[model samples]
Target: ILRETETDVLVSYLPVGAEEATKWYVEQALTAGCAFVNCIPVFIGREPYWRKRFAQAGLPIIGDDIKSQVGATIVHRMLARLFQERGVRLERTSQLNVGGNMDFYNMLERERLESKKISKTNAVTSMLDHELDPSDIHVGPSDYVPWLSDRKFCHIRMEGRTFGDVPLNLELKLEVWDSPNSAGVVIDAIRCCKLAMDRGLSGALIAPSAYFMKAPPVQYKDDKAHRMVEKFIADLMRMDPDTARKVLNNEITAEQAVQIFERLDPETARGVIKAGIFNVEGLTPIRGAAKVAREFGVDYGKFTEEENTYLRGLMFLFYAWTRQNTPNWFRYITRNPGGFLAKFLAPWFAVVLWNNTIDEELEQSLPPWKRDQLHLITGYKDEDGKDIIIYFRGAPFVDALE
Candidate 1:
């Protein structure tokens, strides 16, 4: 179909957590010289390995879950932000969504809903600067009622305390047509990918993915991401498609491209994009290397290019797991930097400084599933969809790696 139609982009509106099917589509897009926009919860854009692949292939990509314009997750995120800004201590919150479409029916199996649950829960919790306990927040599809036929009903409850120890609570019930809720957002995502292709840009589109998807490769505050998207479209609109491509290929040098994006002020960088001063002719996405380093708060100027890339990959991997497992630790590191194991103290150089520190330290401390594996897959019961465990006291580990 792609060869016959000359399709340059592939949009996966596949059902949530369709990992096996999505993996095939990913390969197909790469083989076909096509961009990919994923609208499901199974991760791709957020994964370092795949993001690097798409970038290396010079293909634009966005994912991992598309967000509805006015759905439960978005609403809950806004409320969470509101509570924070207003000096209210948000204690706990939960969102329950029920829909009657086949989308909902497929999700009735609890085991199949892991990614969906994580996507929704993260969308809300990310709004607050403080840590939200896993036990205190719940967000996911609750049940399916066939008679309602494509309509979704969401219940959101928030419990918080305001200044002076006063209790505050909010309860909201949202109803919308499930099928059409995300259509507009997906359409906009399609246009953005086309724009990236036209401008000779590839890899993860950091801004559009944040505003339009639940699990962007880089998560920005919703308002900031929205502003960036607006600026992105407005800036790109000033250049003709062919001229944009020409500028990308001919007008920019790699050094200037990295400086214009990674070192320049945000406003200046957008102006450069608008003025057609930056391009990825020799550079690529996450822009081959620099953008990833800068965006993730690393200063890689002193490091060699290869060292920078390797370090960025490590940071990216660390962030991917930290986003789910140890958000508090992640927050601590990002916010205060010097609070790990020996606060107000230092590792003794005299005690033992060996090359073994790198491998020996992490290998012993991190869980086997995390340290030794590249990917982890869990099985689901055929009847009810609850998770299935596969670990044993002395089992081989190769199967877990895949």
Candidate 2:
């Protein structure tokens, strides 16, 4: 069917009872050159062997389990985060789910529920900062009710202690249509897989998987996962085929690709600068000067007389006397200098030494004749009309007198 339809993506909604069949289905999907979206609790996306096989085949795969739009797992995870953020120590939690769907009926075989339990448990536990004992958190399908039809009910409770050892507890009851709860999430995941295929992207997509799946290839905080997915979608929309290829090949970042595209439009380039995207400090002077010249169409060499004079004075203040300084030193000062005068003198001259014993030792080490010459050159005269050396280290007078 995949070969005949030329399917771009394969959505796996198989039940846990068909666990052994998933391997054959995955192999078939890979052989058919279809991107795989694992919507079940099986561990294809999380397993290293399957991930590497899909990556080697150059096909994108997303998921280990689908997440509902507003399901019991998400509510429990959010409440856990709230408790942690409010300085409450979460001691124990549990979620009891009852549904009438085939999913719930299939889960009646407890032997098939180990993965489901682990997946849902980790979905909530990952939001916590502290370790939770395995016995403390219970999350799994509790019962099956034939009369409820498609309706599913979830009861979640969290037990914790607040400051001053005050006990705090929360309980929530969620009623949702079991199948439809995850239908929207599965659709979004399929679309993400299709987008990755269109962009020639291979391997597990971290952002979409983290945002849409219960047990993804990698887990991230919900807010961070949302932002990553947003950026991923925005990048796909902004990048052309070649740019997308470059990004997937690790040649450039999404921001760099955006900049490359923005540079083509002079107005956008100006807007980017105005928005302070590239107006950050610590940029190379030459690069900053060139950007200004190129964007505004100004000739840097043809400055006005006042501007030229100011520039000359600035250069003199920055680099007037450095005979022994390395080229790298000048490059470093050009980007990050303590003071303008520090560029011309030794790098250590920028700092004021506060050790009187070191100052005295330095003074005693200087030859009397050189000290006299240093004082004479610097024009230093005490009340006795004698040359008095303050500190000879890192001083311009030392080189001048020498």
Candidate 3:
């Protein structure tokens, strides 16, 4: 049927927890040379085995679970991140969602909810620096409200300690149209999948998945993921075929981009450098520190104290990531250290006093992205350095910014 319709991408919106059914659909897509967008939690993109299979077949797949634009997961994530950014120690939190949709009804069965629980839990917890005991952080569907018909009501409560160990608590409720809430995001995911196909890229598209899916293989901070999505959308249209291949290198296609990413130790620094937005080349990863500021422009004058501090922390993180992951990357640090701390840290001391970030900064429950795992540290170039595009792996569709 897909072949007859000339389907370019196959999106599976099968019943929740239908792994066997989803896998069957995946095989159909694979057989038909089509990209896939898995909207339900069946682990096609998150699992290494399935990812490898998709990469070898040269097709992109973007999800274990889809994230609605401003849906429950995203709201929880943003609020949780607020606590972290504000120095509030999140002690306990729970998100109880009740909807009138059939999705809520299907979730009544515990057997179908294992993956759902994991997906929702991970989506929110991935933002925290502190680890919550399994019992402390509760995230999952609660009950079905037949009268609410496609309307979801979410109640959230957060308990934590503030400065001087002062007790602080927050509680809020949100009501949204369950089905329509995901329409924008799902449409965007579909478009992104098509974009990946057009580029001849395959496997789990890190940037798109991170921004649009709850259980992407790699989870980046939402702000960063948002920028990555912007760069991703524009990057492809700007790059020619050969150059695009050089920059985006989907699914470890070449293992490394020694071509322009410049090898530090092909063994230790097992990662890909994406210069799609900046359109520059041969830039040291050190200067990548000011990426957020450069990309989004943190107006020091306009930024609140909290915003500046966050930006500073992000810049500092870029420094530590470089020092720990690829020390030799310093060869070009003198070029551009970024506007955030260009004068204070650049030529020498920027990386000196940097402390390590918590591992929870990335994935904690699932496979953490180690040096051996395929890592795509995508960002824009702060300046022009000849038009050079590269990729070892691949992606899928949604115009997130749109």
As for model 2, its CA RMSD to the true structure in angstroms is: 15.9
Q: Which has the better TM-score: candidate 1, or candidate 2? A: 2
Q: Write one digit per residue (lDDT tens) for candidate 1, span 1-402.
A: 776788988999888768899999999998888999999999999999998898788788989799998998889889999999999988889899988999999997888899999888888888888888899988999999999899999999999998789999999999999778999999999999988887667788888999999999888888999998987776566443433443344443332223223433455445435432222344422122223333333222345544333443323322222233343333333443221322111121001111212335433432233344332221112235322211111111222111
- Report the alpha-carbon TM-score of model 3 versus the true structure: 0.63
Model 2 residue 320 CA deviation (Å) reads 36
Which residue pairs show collisions in model 2? Answer: none
Please tell me which predicted candidate would have the highest lDDT against the true structure: 2
Prediction 1 TM-score vs. true: 0.62
Residue 374 displacement in candidate 2 (angstroms): 42
The weakest ten consecutive residues by lDDT in model 2 span 316-325
* lDDT (10s digit) by residue, model 2, range 28-128: 99999999999889888988889889889989999888889999988888899899889999999999999998989988999989889889999999998
What C-alpha lDDT do the candidate models reach, one value each?
0.66, 0.68, 0.66
